[model samples]
Target: MDERQAINAGKAALITLAVICLGALGVLVWEYATTKEVTNTAAVAVLLVSGGLFWAFERMFGAEAPRSLLGRELPTGATAAERAERRRAYAVDALALAISGVVLGIGGFMLGDPDAFGSLGLPGGPVTGAVLGFVALFVISFSLSWLVGEADSRAVEKRLARLEAQV
Candidate 1:
């Protein structure tokens, strides 16, 4: 397909994925509200599907956009800087996803066992776990993002140097 057509297709696919995600989320919420019970199966399905969507999104539009998502190599058309930027964007997206997963996992655990935290003498129960999990997720995600960004920068610099030497 031509570039414009490919872009349009990608956009359509993204919208469809988003709608599917929303529908899944709605079902999850409805199930929880009606049952008044923590459903691990539904929650896990949502998380897994969401994570798959995130990965698909990154593969489709991040550093590999210039090439087909199924392609194994980076396209020659993308400059080092552009690739680096895309990599950084992917890192941020991944970090956000990690944080979300942590929160969701903790929330699920809390809902499944209300007294799990109370036995520890924590005043606010799951709130304390949520807070701690958030802090830990932030720290871990930030560190990982920084490392990925640094690696991307190094790769870009090396590519630029090689290009400069060839000229």
Candidate 2:
């Protein structure tokens, strides 16, 4: 396929995957609460409903840039300082998102089976793979945001500095 077609396909696939994931996650919570496994038909119905809701949400709150769907990084502001600041901001955001995802995923996993992790002789070891997978998901989203066009880097830098000073 051509580059454009490939990108489009990739975007669609990613969105669908995310939607299905949401449904599966719902199933997990449901199963945990009820202690009953979901049947194939119920699972499929839940998946469809959840996916539709997610799609609707996306449509209602569309991205500012269409290129973002195709993994285009945003442009930074002009001047060296502005560019540096933008890069730093992106890196910080990406790292924070990735770390948060992994941490939360591991926490949830442990909550579900605390002894399972401790028994492994390595705390967090049992859930490490799943945690990393969650982090990867966050990283993908961050990477796509990073691909958007450059912003007013100087403004961003000043705002970040102010926020840092406030903390």
Candidate 3:
């Protein structure tokens, strides 16, 4: 198959893997919450298998093709409404980041507080680790969104260039 087709196939495979991993993780979490014993082996195995599959696919198909999903695509000469829509995309992204940061911050605060879940009998080290983990999640999430937005802007510029060349 051509590179584009291969890349699409790889993306589909990765997406399927992600869904399966998430499902398995959800099951693990549910069992742990209900029974107090972590049934995480299956989830771990799924993650390992998916990671191997992704590595193999990347080796076979090469790097992924550049892609952008900024809500709506704009043409070479965008209308005023389209320009506004583009700005709205960034605004929506900022709103999402703000919301996520708040949620993560709350979680981190609750976990760090010994009184929040006193019955669980979590040790201080684990609580500290969990709090730090949430902080890392907040930072990583915002960084990823920023990187993706930058990539989308570059992709739009390239698309505009191609459209101008055709004129």
Top candidate by lDDT: 1
lDDT of 2 by residue, 100-129 (tens): 666666686667955432354555665666
Off by over 4 Å in 3: 48-70, 73-92, 100-141, 148-167
- Model 1: how far residue 86 lies from native, Å: 11
Model 1 clash number: 0
Q: What are the lDDT scores of the predictions, listed in order?
A: 0.60, 0.57, 0.59
For this target, which candidate reaches the highest TM-score against the unseen true structure? 3
RMSD (Å) per prediction = 9.9, 13.3, 8.5
Candidates by TM-score, descending order: 3, 1, 2
Q: How many residue pairs clash per model?
A: 0, 14, 0
TM-score of each: 0.42, 0.36, 0.44
Tell me the deviation in Å of residue 94 in model 2.
1.2
Between 2 and 3, whose lDDT is larger? 3
User: What would the per-residue lDDT of candidate 1 be over residues 24-107, giving only the tens digit for each residue?
Assistant: 777777888999865768655876787788667644533222222233333332477766655555455556765786667666
